[model samples]
Target: MSKPLRVGVAGLGVVGASLARLLQRQSEALASRTGRAIVVTAVSARDRARDRGLDLNGVAFFDDPRALAGSESIDVFVELMGGADGPAYDSVKAALNSGKPVVTANKALIAKHGLELARLAEEKGLAFAFESSVAGGVPIIKTLREGLAGNSIRRIYGILNGTCNYILSKMETDGLSFEECLKEAQRLGYAEADPTFDVGGFDTAHKLAILASLAFGTAIDAEAIHVEGIETITQDDLAAADELGFRIKLLGVAERTARGVEQRVHPTMVAKSTAIAQVMGVLNAVTIDADAVGELTLVGPGAGGDATASAVAADIVDIARGVAIQPFGRPAHMLEEVERIPMQRHEGGYYVRLMVVDRPGAMAAIATRMGERKISLESIMQKGGARLARRRTDPPPAEGAPETVRVVLITHATSEQAIREALDLALADGVVTQKPQVIRIERE
Candidate 1:
C-alpha cells in the first residue's frame, strides 16, 4: 500500500463540508486510481461549534485557517473561504510559501490577484490549481490548460452567473417583473440578500476575466472588462426580445478581435434556437472558439455545494497524483500583458427599446439618426397603451399628452460608439421620452 496524501480544508461552509465528505466517501476509489490514499486531516472555520451535518470527530479542527495551511500533517491546502483579500488570501499564500500544493474555489481571488499568485506559486514550484474558479464543475481550467492546449483560442464567452440567469429565466418564463423574480430567487436561496455581486454582473466579470487569461495566455484583468447588470431589464424589454425570436441572457464575452481583446459582461441577445439560449435557469455554459477545434461548449451547474466541491476535489486528486501544469496554461514569465480593446470598438447587433412620443416624424427621426450612424434596423415593434409605471418614490415621466409608444429595434452589427451617438441624438431631438435601452446581440 502507498502512503496517504494528507489534505487540509479551510472553511467548513457548504462547499468545505461537501469537499470533506467527498474526500472521505471517495477515499478507496481515489486511492486505487491515484496509487495513494487521500486523507482529510484537518479543517478550519470561524464557527467550529456549529453543526456541519458531518462527523469531524477524527479530523483536527482549527479556528485560524492559517494554522491548517501550515500544519505539518497536511500536504495540500484546499481553500473554500469566500473572500479575495482576507484570511483566505493569507492562508493560501502561506500554504504555497510553505512548499505545499494549494487548490482554491475563490474566483474573486483568482480573478483579481491571479497573476501575482501564479508567479509566486510557480516561483515556489508548487501546484496552484483553481479549476472551480470559473464555471463550477465544468473543468474548464483543465480543458483550456491541457485538453485544448494545441489550438489558438480566438474567443471565449459564456453565461457565467447563475443568479442572473435564474432571474432572467424567471422573467422570460413566468412573465414576472425583475423585482418579483429577484425576490423569489432570494427566498429560494438562489440569490444573496444583497445580491449586488451576482445581479450587478461583477461576479460574472470576475469569472470571465480569469477565463480570458487562460484562453489568451495573458494576465488577469478583471477591472478592464466592461460590465452591465440585468437589473434594468424590464418586462417590456423581455417581451420585445421574445417577439424578435431572441432571448436575453446576461453573458460574459471575451473575444480576440482585430483591434484587441474584447472582454465584456452585459445583457446579451442570443438567438432562441442556439444551445446557449436553451441553457436556462441556474446553469452555466462556456463556449471556446479555437483555431483548430472550432467551437466547443461546456455546460453544467455554475455553483452549489456538491458541484463546486466536486471540482475542488478533482484538483486535489490531480495534485495527489502529481499532475502538475502551468497556472495560466503557460509559464508565468511567458504570459503577456493583455491589451484590452475599447468598448467603443466592439461591433455587434443590438436590441434597442425606445420610449417615443406617439406622433408623426418621431419614428422617422429615430430612423434617420440610425441611418446617419449606418445602423440598419432588422425589426421594430410599437407596443400600444403602454404607460410608464412608477414604483414607490420613482418619479413619473414628465406630464404630457404624449402617447407612450415602445419602439423596439433589432440592429445589424455596428460600432458601440455609433449606437451611443445615435441614441444621444434621438434623446436630444425630443423623439425619445426616456433614455433608449440598448442590449448587445451576440451571434452564437
Candidate 2:
C-alpha cells in the first residue's frame, strides 16, 4: 500500500464540503488512479459546530484557516475560501510560503494576485494550481495552457457567469422583465441576494483575467479589462434581438488585436444559430480560436457543488501524481507586458434601441447624428411603442399627438466611442425620450 496523500481544505461551504465528501467516498478509486491514497487529514471553516453531513472521524479541525495551511497534518493545502483578500489571501500566502502545494478555486484572488503567488510557488519549487477558478467544471485552463500549447491562440471568450446567464436565459425564453427574472434567480439560489458581483460582470471579468493570462502568456490584468453589466437589458431587447436573428448573452471576450490585447465583458448579441447563443439557463460555454485548433468550444454546467468540487479534486489528483504544470503555462516571470486595449476603441456591430417622439423629421435627426459619426446602418425598424413604453416617464406622449415610436437600429462595425458620441448627439438633440439601450453584436 502506498503512503496516503494528506489533504487539508479551508472553507467548507457548498464546494468545500462536496470536495471533502468526494475524497472520502472515492478514496479507493482515487488511490488506484494516482497510485496513492488521497486522504482528508484536516479541515477548517467558520462554524465548527455546523454539521456538513460529512463524517469527520479522526480528521483534525482548525478554527483559523491560516493555521490549517501550515499544519503538519497535511501535505497539500486546498483553498476553497473565496474573496480577493482577508482570510483566503492570508491562508493561501501562508501555505505557499511554507513550501506546500496549493489547489484553489478562488478566481478573484487569482485575477488580482495570481502573478505574485505563482512566482512565490515557483521560487520554492512547489505547485500552485487553480483549475476551478474559471468555468466551474470545464477543463478550460488545461485546454488553453496544455492542450492548445502547439497553437497560437487568437481569441477566447465565453458565457462565464452562470447567474447572469440564467437571468438572461429566463428573460429570453419566458419573456420576463429583468427585475422579475432576477428575483426568480435569487429564489432558486442561482444568484446571491446582493447579485451585483455576478450580474454586474465582475465575476466574469475575474475569470477572463485568469484566462487571458494563460491564453496570451501575459501578466494578469483584471482591472484593465472593460466591464459592462446586463442590468440595463430588458425583455424588449430580447424581443428585438429575436426579430434581428440574434440572441443576447453577457460575454467576456479576450483577443489579440493589432493594437494589443483586448478584453471586455458586456452583453453581446450573438447570431441565433451560433453555439453560444444556443446555450441557456445556468450552463456555460467557452470558445477558443487558435491557429491549430481553429475554433473549439467546450460547454457544461459552469457552477454547482459537485461540478466545481470535481474540478478541485482533479487538481489534487494531479498534484498527488507528482504532475506539476506552470501556473499560467509559461513561466510567470517570462510573461510579457501587453498594452490593454481600450473599450472605446473596440470595433464591433451594435444594436441600439431608442424611443423617440413621433414628430416630423425625428427619424432624419437620428440618421443624421449616426451619419456624422460615419456609422453605417445594417438595418433599421420602427415599431409600436412598448407596453411599459415610457421608461423616461415623458408625460404619457401628450394625449392627442402621435404616440412615442420605438426604433431599433443595427449598425455596421464601428468604434464604441463613435457610437456613444452619435447617441449623445441624438439624446442631446431631445429626440430620444430617455437613455437609449445599446448591446454589442458578436458575429461568431
Candidate 3:
C-alpha cells in the first residue's frame, strides 16, 4: 500500500467533527479502494479543550488555521472554516500557495473567488475540489463536472437551500403561515436565528453561481443572479398553487439564453408532477437539461453534518487515489466571462396574486392593464364571496378602508417586463390595494 494521505482539517464545527468520524470509521474500506490510508493528522479550531467526541489523542492541534495550511505534517488541507473573505480565505490561499491539494465545503468562498483560486491551483498542478459546496451529499458537482461532460447542458436548477425548502414545505402541508413555519424551522435548528441568509435566497444564489460555472463553462458571478426571498409568500399563494396543480419551491436556476447565461433564485411554481416539486422539507433536488441526457434530477438530503461530510470525504478519497481535475471542470484560463442578463429579459409563465378592491369594474381595470401590456391570462381564480376575505395574518382593516378580495391570475408565457409593467399600472390605477405577489411558473 502507498503511504497514508495526511489531511489537516480546519474548523471543528459539526461538519468538521463529522468528517473526522467518517474518516476513522471508513479507514479500512477507503484504504482498500484507494490503495492508501486516508488519515486525519491534525485539526485547527478556537478552543483545544472543547470536546468534539473524536479521538484526537495523537493528532496534532493548531490554534491558527494558517499554520495548519502550510504545515509539513499534512499532505492535504481541508477547509471547513467558512467565510468568503476572512481567515477561511487566507488559509486556503496559503495552502494552495504552499503547493498542497485543497478540499473545501465553502460555497461562498468558491462562488466569490473561484477563478483566482482555480488559476492558482492550475499553476501549481494540484487538485482543488469542493464537492460539498453545492447540494451536500448529492454529488451534483461531480455529475456536472464529470458525469455529464459529453452532454451540452442547457439548464440547471434546484432547491439548493434546505432551510428555505423546509419552511416552504411546512407552510404548504400544514396550512401554516410563513412566519409560523419560519419560527418552527428556527426552533428545530433547521434555520439560523437570523435566517436571512438562507430564507432570503442568498445561499441558493451562491450555489447557483458555482453550478452555472460548471455547467456553462462560464466564470462565477454571484452578483449577476436575480434573487427574491420567500418573505412575501403567504398561505393564500400556497392554496392557489395547490388548486392550480402546482407546488411552490425556492429554486436556483441557470440557463442558456440568447443574451447570456441567466441565473436567478426565487420562489417558483412547479407542477406537482415534477420531480423537484415532490421533494419537501430539508431534502433537495437538482434537475439538469442536456442535449444528450434530456432531463436528469438528483434528489437527496441537502444538509446535515453526516450528509455534507460524506461529500467532503469523497473529495479526500479522490485525492488519496491521485485523481486530479480542475476545480470548475475545465482549465481556469478557458472559463468564459458570463454576460450579465437582467431579470427583465426573463420570459416565462407567471402566477400573479393581487389584493383588489371588491367592487364593480375592479377586475375589468386589472384585465385592461394586462391587455395594455399584451399579457394574456391562462386562468383566473377568485377566492372569497361577496364579503371581504382578509388573511388571518393581515393587520386589522382601518376605519374606512375598501373591502378587498384575493384574485389570482395565471398568465401564459410572457416577458418579465410585461408582467411588471402591468402590475405597476394596476397598482397606480388603484385597482390593486397592496403590492402584488408575482411568482415565476416552471411548466416542467
lDDT of each: 0.89, 0.91, 0.94
Q: Which stretches of candidate 1 lie above 4 Å from their native place? A: 384-399
* Per-residue lDDT value at 224 in model 3: 93
User: Which candidate ranks first by lDDT, i.e. highest?
Assistant: 3
The parts of candidate 3 lying over 4 Å away from their true place are: 386-388, 391-396
**Number of the predicted model whose TM-score against the real structure is largest:** 3
User: How would you encode candidate 3's per-residue C-alpha lDDT over 144-249 as one tens digit per residue?
Assistant: 9999999999899999999999999999889888899999999999999899999999999999999999999998899999999999998888999999999999
Which scores higher on TM-score, 2 or 3?
Answer: 3
Ranking by lDDT: 3, 2, 1
Tell me the tens digit of each residue's lDDT in model 1 across 1-444. 668999899988879999988888998999998999999889999998899888888899988999889889899999998899989899999999888999999999998778888999999988999999998888898998899989999988899999999999999999888999999999999999999999999999999999999898878999889999999998878887888898999999999888888899999998899888889999999988899999898999999999999999899888988987888989988987888677988998998988887778889999999999999988877756345332334455567646657778888889999999999999899989888899999996
Instruction: Look at candidate 3 and tell me the lDDT of residue 3.
Output: 97
lDDT of 2: 0.91
Local accuracy of candidate 2 as per-residue lDDT tens digits, 1-444: 668889999989999999998898898899999999999999999899998899998999999999999887899999998999999899999999987899999999999899999998888888899989999999999999889999999999999999999999999889788899999999999999899999999999999999998999989999889999999998779999999999999999999888789999999999989888889999999999999879999999888889999999999999999988889998889998758787889998999999887788898999999999999999998875544555554466556655678899999999999999999999899888769999999876
For residue 311, model 3's alpha carbon misses the true position, in angstroms, by 0.6
